[model samples]
Target: MQASEVDYLIIGAGSAGSVLAGRLSEDPGTQVTLIEAGPADRSVLIHCPAGLALMAKSRQLNWGFETVPQPGLNGRRGYQPRGKVLGGSSSINAMIYMRGHRADYDAWAAEGNAGWSYEEVLPYFKRSEHNERGADAFHGTGGPLNVMDLRSPNPFGPRFVEAAKEAGFAANPDFNGAEQEGVGLYQVTHKNGERCSAAKAYLTPNLGRPNLQVRTGALVTRIVLEGRRAVGVELLEGGQTVTLRARREVLLCAGAFQSPQLLMLSGIGPADELRRHGIAVRHELPGVGAHLHDHPDVVLVYDLPGATDLFGLSLAGAARVWRGIGEWRRQRSGMLTTNFAEAGGFIKSDAAEPIPDLQLHFVIGKLVDHGRKTVFGHGFSCHVCVLRPRSRGSLRLASADPRAAPLIDPAFLQDPDDLRRMVLGFKQMRDILNRPALARFGGRELPASASARSDAEIETFIRNHADTIYHPVGTCRMGTGALDVVDTTLRVRGIEGLRVVDASVMPSVVGGNTNAPVIMIAEKAADLIRAQA
Candidate 1:
């Protein structure tokens, strides 16, 4: 498998790449090599489900990308923490196993992607999951990724649901069920209390296969092209430039940002923009890094006095975390098993809206600045975001050098409609947070959002604090339009041997958390590729 050439030379051993490698290598005759720019996913911080909080400040396994100054956030740069590890963002994400609303995918099919409607893609989602709840019309069993309720959920999570109920939202047991509306505790990508990331689900188990080879710390610099067709790639590994030939195809699964960067770096992007970066354009695809969008979320923090169940930086909290660590080591069950965003829901910005256009994530902590800035108290936070934002953004190269981080401009809140929905979404979430069910534990609202009384005040607060909930997609969009980078089968429109099989290929960001959908994309992609082979 380590030979100079492989049948599938997959770049980026993240969510999609892991699935692609695992599925493609199921054929004993096929050779697959999965490359990751980061080190191995062997960190205790990575395996321990609760370690993500500490990962916020550590660059050890994160591509800590900061957006260019955004005009909408009063020119403040947004923080974008992408996983640089094996499972990609799924390894560092909140681990909520959410499949967006059905209509979201139906819309994709309607946009000319024939095989991407909800009913068409649902099987792939099921095929990739081993839901503890067992096989059903909407869920599957005996699959690589394990989906289950938290092993040791914080009691406050149920209270959050109750609070949402008091605010008039129904309690839904499964957000991925028939209806996406209503509050509930989220299912996580976990098995026996630990994370079941895409790597763990699809790649790690198959690493022993003679046909699958995984190389870590190998940063792919550029795709080696010949007459507009991808033949292989040139990468930097062990301080040496290495060229690996692809006998079949070169798959780009580097997620939204790097996927497009590698495409442009390889001389396939907007002609003029590539010229400015001194890259010779091999293809004039203007949509490589265009049509970028993500969920824009705002959080409200409130102190919860005398709450020992919540995570905090206090003395008592330290003692609890210490015990939780020991408990997790012995049984893989404890507070450590909890994904911080324990409870949430999909609700509408207004009744007139066709589907839920807003989503919520209630954390059993005061998640200040995505948990990078520590707040010293026992408290909880509730996040509400415009699920389908009108704002669009773009990612562009800052330099021709492959090592440089690209200029990311999410253009959050650039559309006035997104801002309007945020104001209304904020009011609805504030009402849920202030309901009687959540009042038993605590104190006043955090100063940042408490004083906002009028709609204008809420709008100001939203503009000041809102940023991505980490679902960025549509950079290498798939459609029949002129700007489409890939086609229905995810093949790059103008390239023969290159295809994007990550979140970047999503024509539109889905309605909820994106990890599950990304995995589904890779699952269906594996089938499409095999069908062709």
Candidate 2:
């Protein structure tokens, strides 16, 4: 059958893809088609904030990608769960609305990529946000995506603030404000009591527009390239093969791991790797799958028998939650509105560093291995992740089949410096928990930090327990150098009519959560595409 044609064909109905489709289709003359490998974002587990804890275990909503055994992590494969639904990870994430540090974007521009400075990109960040606190110099008010404070946080949430002050960090209400060096409650991408996924904010609203089309369960197998230009995509839908052509551009927003995997499967990666997989080399882009990295995090879990505000598996805890459901239904305010990682802050492990090298996530649950492991009892956990790391890894083709999962290696903590910073971060979290503010909650560490008194012991603990914080980037990095996969405008190097607009294009991972920054990227890319047109 002849392929259906559109002005723009987008792969992956993720944060970026959803935003792109919405923005591009705003021009009634521009026809856009978006395809998602996963199903629609309709699960109740996806919309409810409290359901996120349970959603972490829903296989149908997660891509369930795992990393290769890291020699640095005692040969344990890290568990990675990217969202498989319409909103992508944003649909399943903690919804923390962080835009990263300002210096991060300045460094991106300083690295020879023009138009990415903090000043240049700030507008885009503001453009996509609809803050509940109203419009201001730092935030936008009427944008599609909602940003608001949790309707009701756990009672222990305030204790985290007091603990941070007791631990010597200044209290700042906004992490995205003038100064980022402080402790505070996180603002989440939630409105009322529901998750404000990218699909909910962008795609769903535009579904009624005549210029846009969305297809779920459309797994793109490869980019159908003609010589050096991408013309369309070959995909499998409902056991039937289909081809969809793009009249103007083909955008790959399949994210860090799969975006590069798609490029390689379409014969656009390292020549040697492509040849080994028995695929014809269309273009040899050596940097297609290089520099894969993520924030390596360790959690300090503590038993909280005295706490009733936290979610737990105990009978009393269940009863409290049952009451919370009624409260939520009646007023849309209660413990059910909790994002779990409700209170967190940024801090510098080393005073000499220009910005905070460590980021914290205070969870009101015993989160273990992405919440896949069940630990009995009531508890609270604090997660500390190195904001940036020197270690680098890669993505490679495990099989030529597009349906096969790619071999992902994040090479977590391969650098000794990364391990050292993590040690400091771990100590910092322990210090806060030991403070009088949190001590009143009556809890003890799970792994017993009493044994981890020295650097060697802490390193051993990290190697045995560290895992991904789920922010992966740089596999299809954008820059003007040969080592970069895309240019400043996100166009793939040595290719025409093709661009990657997702976390994969980030030259380096941002300092905090990635969802907000991804939306900003698509907002900026839309203007770039329009200007060129």
Candidate 3:
């Protein structure tokens, strides 16, 4: 059957897809269609900032993906939960608004990605943010997405900031501002204590537009290619197969994992791999699933010495929770409205470096294995992760069928340098916790014994406990290199009318949270597409 054609057919209403749809559809003459495999963003758990942990393991709103067994990780498979909802991972994430280091972006431009330098992309970051702090040279006030500080943070949040300072890190009020080399409370994508997911910021308000059509539960099977050009997509909707066409362009925004998977399924990947799977090759892009990277983090849980933690919720604590819920249901404030990863910072493992090499997240409660169950009483957890890992991995086709999940091999810690960096990162985390400022509030739960001091012990800890901090990128890297899947303009290397505008195109993983950067990429891509129009 013939299908309806739109000006822009956006596959995946994720962080980038939503923003692209909203921006491109602003001109009434352009028609945009955004397809998402998941359902709508109607879950209360998604909006409640404190409820992020509960949604982490929920398959209802997440694509509960696990990696192929890794030899370096003692043959253990790691859990990778990505958002399958309207806003994608942004809906279920901790909402930290970090842009990483300026050096990270400059490195991308240095690698032939011309317009991605820190100076060039900073305006896009500012243009997309409606910071509560008001308009400045570094922040935008009338943007779609809202960026604000936590309404009220955990008591330990302030203490963590002081601890970081005592450990020799400067107090940086904004990681996305003038500098990123410090420790302090993180700003989040929130407005008046509610989540400002891309769906909320871009899709929700624009739902009334006549030119925009958003279809949930549309699982794209493959791109509908007319020779080497992508014209649209074939998808499954309500147990029926449907083919949709795009008159102008077909943008893939399915993120780091699925974007490459979709490309491979559409015969736009390595020639040898496609032939191995008995699929015809339309383009021989060998880098479709190469250069996969993620930030792996290890959690150090410690028992608090007093009742100043969130775990100490007695009847008074229950009262506080209830009161906060009431306030959130009414005016949107209090504890219920904050993403509990209240404070965090970046630090250099080696002081001689120009930027930080490690990232930290300070939580006021104990969370073992994605907070499956709450521990009783007061406890704290500091997650230490290497900002830049030397190890690299890839995504590959398990089968030619698009319905089959792609094989993910993160190859974490395969490089000895990664292990060394993780050791230093953990040691730095220990230094912060041992500082006099934090020592007054908590004692060591995990002591730094001889095992903690040994290289073998640290390596074992990393292999056994390290999991994704939820930042994954570089599967379909953008550059002018021979192995690059996309060029600097986000257009596919060998295909026309096909662009990848998501985390998949990151030439290298940014040092901090990826949501803000992903949104900035979409904001930039929108302008590029408009210029083409």
Best by TM-score: 1
Angstrom error at residue 84, model 1: 0.5
* CA RMSD, predictions in order: 0.7, 1.4, 2.1
Q: Lowest summed lDDT over 10 consecutive residues: which window, candidate 1?
A: 435-444
Per-residue CA lDDT of model 2 for 164-207, tens digit only, reads: 89999899899997888788899999987889999999998889
lDDT of 2 at 3: 33
Question: How many times do residue backbones clash in model 3?
Answer: 0
Tens-place lDDT digits, model 1, residues 1-533: 56889988999988999999999999999999999999889988888899888888879799999899989888999999999999988888889999999999999999999999999999999999999999999999999999999999899899999989999999999999899999999999998989989999998899899999898999999999999799999999999999999988999999899999999999999999999988998999999899988999999998976687899889999999999999999999999988899999999988999999999999999899999997897999999998888888999998989999999988999999999888888899989888888887665799988999999888888889998899999999999999999999999987888899999999889999999999999999999998988
Mark the 10 consecutive residues where model 3 has the least summed lDDT: 442-451
The list of candidate 2 runs beyond 4 A from truth reads 1-3, 448-450
Between candidates 1 and 3, which one is better according to lDDT? 1
Assess every candidate by TM-score. 0.99, 0.98, 0.96
User: Residue 75 error for model 1, in Å?
Assistant: 0.4
After superposition, candidate 1 runs with Cα above 4 Å error? none
lDDT of 3 by residue, 341-394 (tens): 889898887888778889999987776777765665567789988888888999
